[model samples]
Target: MLIGVFAASLAFQAGSAFAESYQGLLKKGYTVGKMSQGKSGSLGWVLTGKDGKQFCKSKVSLAVVDKKTLVSILASGRMVKVDRATFEAGIGGPDPSLPLLSDLKAGRVGPQHVGACTPLRG
Candidate 1:
């Protein structure tokens, strides 16, 4: 019965975590952009959000079996799981080279030449 209790507790915790992560993603305006299946059967997702002025993108890698309850790794090397508050808070920010969400909100980073994600070949 101890094993059963432990399993029940784990399920509850996972459910709570999933809920938090889902809410956070929604609050941060992330929508599913693309999905791909990895070789190991894990799922990969690219999350995209736009402020109507600029775009924010993140990639998440997770297991398909526990898609909802898994944490994803961002391209920025940040580990993000499905906890809405933390994800939202963590995602919508700025970098020194790129315009931050806060700056965009405040009308700081105008619709100008934001740098490209890739460098010019020529």
Candidate 2:
């Protein structure tokens, strides 16, 4: 019984220790690069810092919706359904009018306005 309790405690600690959110890391100056595949065949974005240093080696994947690929998840885990066109705008681009990574960090687009961003455990 004591062993069981110890193991449960360890499991909880391990999960919490590594459960850093995508937004949390982005707030720390991490930039999301192009999508890439991991050794396990899973897709995720490469995270880099302002200094050009790679952050997570394995990377994290995002899931916008259950069946639909377009969706946004907030830190609270609230899923907001969005359309493809809207999702593209959230992506930003050469158009300065749209929100970019810098705007994301600057709070131009609220968390809800952003698309799905799930960080994969490397």
Which residue pairs in candidate 2 collide? 60-119, 60-120
Off by over 4 Å in 1: 21-23, 26-122
Weakest 10 consecutive residues of candidate 1 by summed lDDT: 113-122
Error of 1 at 78 (Å): 42
Segments in model 2 whose C-alpha atoms lie over 4 Å from true places: 48-122
Q: Per-prediction TM-score, please?
A: 0.22, 0.35
Candidate 2 residue lDDT tens string, 5-113? 9999999898676545457667878766654443444433455654343323322122333223443433433445556455556776222233233333333343333
lDDT of 1 at 64: 20
How far is each candidate from the true structure, as Cα RMSD in Å?
Answer: 20.4, 10.8
